[model samples]
Target: MKAVVVNEGGALSIQNIEMPKITSPDQILVKVAYCGLCGSDIPRIFHHGAHFYPITLGHEFSGTVVDTGHGVTEFDNGDLICCVPLLPCFKCDECQKHYYSLCKNYTFVGSRIAGGFAEYIVLDKKNAFKLPKGISPLEGAFFEPMTVGMHALLLADGCEGKNVVIVGGGTIGLLAMQCAKAMGAKSVAVIDINQQRLDLAKKLGADAVYHSQKLSSEAIHQALSSSRFDQVVLETAGSPVTVNLSIEIAGPRAKIALVGTLHHDITLPEKTFGLILRKELQILGSWMNYSAPWPGKEWQLVSQYFIDGKIKLDELIAGMGDFDSFIKQVTALNGRPMNGKILLNCM
Candidate 1:
């Protein structure tokens, strides 16, 4: 099996590795067909020494089942499936409380464990979801990120009849916007410094889009004051500036969800405390979809959203280049299209 591995920090290479074998009754082996390169993968590969050297590096993916262990009943060989990627000890207190995403022993594919940047990977039956008939494998590859948005919305409660503002126009941010709209936000606004992403956001149903760089702090304040959105969603990778900017624009009594990974420390405004205290704002953090129901039910939720036209999945795809080319193209971030998710076909 050929897999892309990061030998060490700042080192990446393709090597022939032995295929993973399934030894547990609850495990299933998937022959990967497509995988999406998430922005986090780059930092893990280049900056953080999180992954063991020579480990595969991909988490968001979809494929067909090549084999299943003795007790597997939900799926058989040849079924299309997507993985949740988070491996958890199902007997833990967190798991018992339906907070598997917060399990102390949680591990994810392509990060702390073997992953989908390879020809085959073995996953627990609980982590693999069967794809719906109408969805293509390429689109199915997006289920992981979409599930992140779904999980974030779940944390924020219902979006019905509320004005929602998403800070950042990246893949997660854009996906969150679509999900917020589908959940029935009265209006959805996306903020980004890039016009291309804003245009893409418009195509995907953002009610209003703004160029963050061009707007002065007063202008930003004026804009927020005018819209007065009750819900603020952050998926822009928690860049410090964006974090404070998000807090600055939030309306009174607003609910804010943090779906982005803050790479560096950010300076927050003292007024942020005033808003939280005076307005009773809610701050929530969401991680990957690792809890509840089986992986099949979760993937079905994403698939249903796609089938029912709640999310514009296809429009978010920036390119369909080959797997290797996609790695090169997507890894180099430009201001524009940084907000869109790119897919790579491994088959």
Candidate 2:
């Protein structure tokens, strides 16, 4: 099978490798259909080198079940499925507490195990969920990222009747806006350095959009003086500038959730300490979900929403190209601006 392998930092090559074998009875083999290149995967593959090379690097994907193990009764051949990507040791203390993300022995699909970037990938039958009826495999590839947004909104407390602000207008940031609105936020605003992305956000569901370059701290304060955001969510993984700005614009006692990642050190302003102490703000850091909020709710909530048209997953697709062309497109966007998510059609 042909697969893209990163042998080292700043290196990626497409090569023919042996297909992965099902080594365990609880595993199911899936033939890759489509995989989305997430922002985190790009940096981890090329920048910090956290992704071990000679291994597949895509985690956000969906495929059809080719075969199932002896004990696999829940799924069968021809059934399409998407997984949580986290394979946790169910006996661990954190798993016992239903916090699989914090499990000491947690293993993610793309990072710790062979991921979905190849023609075939194996997943624990326990972690895979059947793709709901009428959900396309392409849209199924987005379930992982959507779950991240769902987790962030849950971590932000409740969005009901609250004014919310989301920093960054990328895929994750835009998805976060939709999640906030679904949770009943009265008004939602998305801010980004890219005008193109902010425009896309408005088209999706953002009630208002602002370009970071056009708005300074004073401008933000003036805009919010009449209606300050009760919840602020940050999905820009670029720098800490937006994180601190989220802090600055938050209403008194507002909740702030950081959903994006920063590779470099983040510094908070000196006044932030005073603001935190005086305003009683609650700041929370969020990441990929652990898959434990409700029974089968992970895919069901998101799948139903997309299937029923509550969220516009179609508009989120920015670019789609063949294998080689797709890779070039991703690498080219390294320092350029992106208005939406990019996908690769491996079939």
Candidate 3:
């Protein structure tokens, strides 16, 4: 089997490796199809960010099942499925409470163990989700990211009939915008410094798009014809500026879900910090998408909405090709901004 392996920090190569086999009764072997490149993959590839060297790095992927272990009754050979990357320790207190994301011990596929950047991989039956009928492998690869936005929405108690503001126009931010609309938000507004992302957001159903570089937070709020978003505000950019803006634009008693992974320590301004107290805001910190019943409703809703044609995945794909093309694309992204998801056809 051919796999892309990062032998050490800042080093990557495509090497023929032994194929993973089903070692447990509750496992399945999947022939890799498409794997989506993530923002986190950038640092793991270019910097010393990976948990270990000589590891295959890809998690958002979909494929066809070639074999299923005897204990796997829900799935069988020829099933099209997407990988749920989070491997939670089922014995932990958090896992017992159905808070899989908050499990004290967790092993992520791409980060902690062998991942899907290869011709084939083995997965635990519980971590493999069958794709709905008519869902392509490429579309199935998007399930992970879609669930990310949905998870935040779920944490905020959903977006139906509410004015929703998503502060970021990146992949996750854009997906969050579409998720809000699909969930019956009265209006969806997106804020971003990138014009291309903002334009794509509009095309994907954002009622209003604001360029954060050109407009002040107050100006953006007024442009939306609202003093502040009283319903929901999702901060998905993970930037300090966007984080502060999320705080400033949230109305009283609003549900603010912090969905992005912040890389730096954020020192909120006195006034910005005061808003949390003054507005009596409900700050919801959402982690990876997982809840009761394992892998939860986020993944289920993403599959349903995608199959129903309510969610868009094609427009969100900025690039797609094989491992060689993926390498070139990664090399070329030298401080360049990525507008959408980049996919690698592993098979």
Q: Which number leads on lDDT?
A: 3
Q: With candidate 2 superimposed using the best TM-score fit, by how many Å does residue 283's alpha carbon deviate from the native? A: 0.6
Model 2 gets an lDDT of 0.76
User: Could you estimate the TM-score for every candidate?
Assistant: 0.91, 0.93, 0.96
Cα-based lDDT at residue 193, candidate 2:
82
Residue pairs with colliding backbones in model 3 are none
For candidate 1, write residues 37-126 as lDDT tens digits: 787776666666554676677888999998999989989898998877887887889878878888898777778888787778999887
TM-score between candidate 2 and the true structure:
0.93
**Tens-digit lDDT string for candidate 3 (295-337):** 8999888877887788787888888888888767766775344
In terms of lDDT, the poorest run of 10 residues in model 3 is: 221-230
239-272 per-residue lDDT for model 2 (tens digits): 7787777777777887877787786798887896
Model 2: residues >4 Å from true position, as ranges? 293-298, 334-339
Worst lDDT 10-window in candidate 2: 290-299
> Which is the better candidate, 1 or 3, if ranked by TM-score?
3
The backbone clash count of each candidate, in order, is 1, 0, 0
